[model samples]
Target: MTSAAPHQSILDKPFVLDLFAGPGGLDVAGHSLDIPSLGIEWDRSACLTRYAAGLDTLHADVSAVRRDAFESLPPEINVLAGGPPCQTYSVAGKGAGRKALEEVKAYIERLMAGDSDETIDRDLKKLSDPRTAMVLEPLRYAIQATRSHNRQKRPYDVIVLEQVPAVEALWHHYAKVLETTGLPDGTKYEVVVDVLDTETYGVPQTRSRAVLIARRQGLGQPFLPEPTHLAYEAKDWNRRAERATSGVHQPTLDAEASAPEAAGPPKTDGVVLKPWKSMGEVLAAPVGTHPGRRTPFLVRSNYGSSGIPGRRGVRTDQQPAATVTGRISRFVVFEHLDERVVREGARFSMNEAGMLQSFPPDYPWSGTAQAQQVGNAVPPVFGAHLLSAALGLPTPDPEDLRKPWQPATVEHRAKLRSHGCGAGDACTARCPRPEDQAPARSSAVPRKKASVR
Candidate 1:
């Protein structure tokens, strides 16, 4: 579906309504671009963090809200942006079973079919099952918004949605529904769907998400954001230079090309995207005796535990970090003095983790729930790229792609002093016992005292 292309200026200042706005990442990105936005989130801790950051927020369950309640919004709320909770749909989640997945699909089909509320409610049988049916909330709102325009009359210009790659098909279905359903004015949305790599957009973490961009009637075809960074797998500097100067537009080269085998042989000439930002660049301490130089370290999550060695735990300073999660504080790293490694380990402080997510340093974290907030947040840098793409605005300069690197200030350090400890306890590490000591002496290593002090 397509429409008359709207000018970039109409997109420049669209009022954005961010659903599932976890910690206001999308809003931060929107505000940075001077696009007015408000975040709606249910997590109190995340809401607190949003408040701390001064983001406009609605602290309510999105599923419970009604469209009429939002009628007071600015007449030009052109962009409806959000990433619904993906726990139920995420492959990493154990609850992602065939039945639940099918139910979500059925939910979308029914909603788009204009089933009565009672009929839809009856079909939602596993209401008690936490993971059941949350994925359809965006469709619910989209339908409600459409209904409102049909009645009270308010129309949105753009809709942007994202989720884990697992939910790509679901989004495709939603897009089809939106594209086919003309508004009372006999207009339809132009929908585009793609899975985007967060790393390709300069977020330090290599997270991938399914994205749906839809522009309301009279706007051009929705488009995915171009990557701003080179894939981490693009190791040939000479090739990078060649591509940088070629000015070629290569869509598949962004994420798919990151995998040499899957993407086939590398193209000597490709997109001009810059190299993926390394976790080290964001988390490593400068090494030297000088004023701005500090030692760096490695963090290992669940270091001493015995298990299947799950997907990833230990993160070295030089690589981009594994995805940040609520438990990101569990990933431990070594502290260094000068060039020597300190065996004692400490995980990323909330400030560092937030920085990795492209949140501002000293973002005024609240409560002890730092990791939870950081982990759930959409990386603001990636969010900014999404916003730019949705708004038809130019992407920010590469230099502006990430939070500026700066050493922690004394006050910042003080604020994060208690952040690295794991849930309900101080920091800990596993150290080898003396070789000759009895089994009794070989107990778990005493928890390491936090090194921040």
Candidate 2:
């Protein structure tokens, strides 16, 4: 975790409301920055999860929530944030039924108006022009309702919505809604379809999401945070940095070399760093071992699992583990030992999996099964970076939270050899029938600690 700098002041921090706040990742980001927030989620488990994180949670469905509820909240809310259910729009679920699409439209409308159950149901049944027609219903209702109330305050000073890239189509309708609601043109709202990886901000996983930030007329366009750590590169193999005690080197390149190549070198004249975190780093220990009793799985099939591992599995000391999913899979890939007790498998723990997605270690999740809850959450770290940018705050640097790895000491190597492999060349040799002796250990290692300032 990065040390908290003395920021401008508490009063300057914005208040936030997180809609469709599954497991509270968005709320977690708000709270971490001392931004008071209210989270609304319909799922009982999700509500409990947010509550566990010390957030004010409303268990009512966003579609059913009345406009008065929003009006009841403090008028100081500067940011309205949420990652509405994406399952209906995700490419994986490609066939986004009209019903599902309408639901999304309704939710947006409600967000705009405050919901009026009587009018919503009647209009939704007859609504056409699926795109605008669906969303405009709630928006129109809300506008009229707010106008009728003659409330002195606007619903929210800023609105942030996150979803898959496909959400751009909905923006046109949302923009129209803004116009109808008296928001002036050139209102300084931005819809970013391409997003940088969250891992670039220090969370171990690489997750790309689309973010939209809309502010009331006066605020400027939200600033996107700059990349902090460069992607790991082969050229950086020899680079070293100074540290408080001994020097530390960056982790050797793993499977991340296959990361989608960038168009060109970054403008920042330093070695490019990888944007995705390795499963090895994220999965520090075996599954079901952490205090939360979460378990990690190997994705063998799309949506099934072989159950969690027990014993007798390959070690993952060198190879990158399987892609972590938000759902269970056919295979079980936890840290386990083979018949020879060789711990050589590519797997991760649930905690590490969440970290890869940039969620804080303590973010709460509640569900009947561990996989269901963890898989359904957004990484809070990613949300924080996104929200920080939306609020025009400087983005947090990924290196600021990265835990530098210490090279294996001589004793550690000896321990590895004792486990089974040969002595001299066994420990350092790369896979694929090792030929040459491992490279000599460097006395002058690069320093790993650098601040963002």
Candidate 3:
């Protein structure tokens, strides 16, 4: 269904409706490309952040919007975009989806077979984790949107969905069903699905995600954009971040270990890939102009605590970060005055975590759970490339990814601080953030703490 067909201008009247729009990640990407987007989120925390960023937001339920599509959504919405909840399918979370992969597939089939909303809702509750069923939400909307397209009424030009790589099989199911949608001259959702490397797209983290891009057949082939940066080579597990403070204590979670391998090597036709961005460079200064942060340091993850000899995760400034998560703040940075003398370890501030996820350094991070919101967000830089590919827009310039972003001055000093920590708590490597939901540390082996001020 893909081709090297001429591109058309979707900018003339583009309106995107992003479901599960956590912290406006994809919306940030959309706005960066001058595309108009409205993100619908049920989480009040996320919606608060969206309002802070000034991203058009609809604080409503996706399923309810599905029921009231015509009344809630405008007729000009051409793009349907979202990443459904993947808690059950995420390798890091419960294995419900994996345990019942066949059952999940069967559910997809049932949804395609025209099951009523009440029936599907009841069936979805049977799963241990209801999030597993949310994956089908996009499909439900697509099926309805395609019906509109068939009637040439408020037709959608494209639909894109993303989720954990473990959900790749589910997306393939989405592809087959959408391909047959609007058949015989209506909007055929010709799709391409695959896993994308975040670092390969200029993000300074090695996170991976499964993506599905579907364009109306009339718009020609919809290809995932070529990687703009070389993929990082994993270093030996024994490698340390240039400090003599402590020996190997825990094993990093190795989030990318479960990332579904791309079906084939990335297509390199007509594009040159640059070296992937480094943690030091991105944290140091805006690629082009800003010069506030001059001191580069090493980042030690709070992820891997699987106490094994020579098993640790240490990221040097020269390397890309492992994965940015809510607990990223717990990961301390060993400030290097020279190379041998290390200063007391300190964790990233709210803005620092945002930058690692490719959000503007000044992006307003409002409300609580700021770290989780930033961590869970789709890297805006990567999203820009994806939207460009899906919407027939010109590929974004590599420099644009590097350009200094306009700072968010939405009452910089007014937003609330950490979710649960007191303003005077003096959070450090040992701060047991009560608000975070990670499992408790293993009590058998005593852990070392970073020297704090």
Clashes of each: 7, 30, 2
Candidates sorted by TM-score, descending order? 3, 1, 2
Which sections of candidate 2 miss by over 4 Å? Answer: 1-11, 90-120, 126-151, 172-196, 229-265, 268-275, 285-325, 328-331, 334-350, 397-453
Candidate 3 lDDT tens digits, 83-133: 877666644446555775566778767766777778878887887755566
lDDT of each: 0.60, 0.45, 0.65
TM-score: the better of candidates 1 and 2 = 1
- TM-score-superior candidate, 2 or 3: 3
* RMSD, every candidate, angstroms: 12.7, 17.6, 9.4
TM-score of 3: 0.77
Tens-digit lDDT track of model 1 for 283-381: 544322112213545455543322323422443454466566666777766654221344675556677777777776556676546777787777788
Q: Kindly give the stretch of ten consecutive residues in candidate 3 with the minimal lDDT sum.
A: 443-452
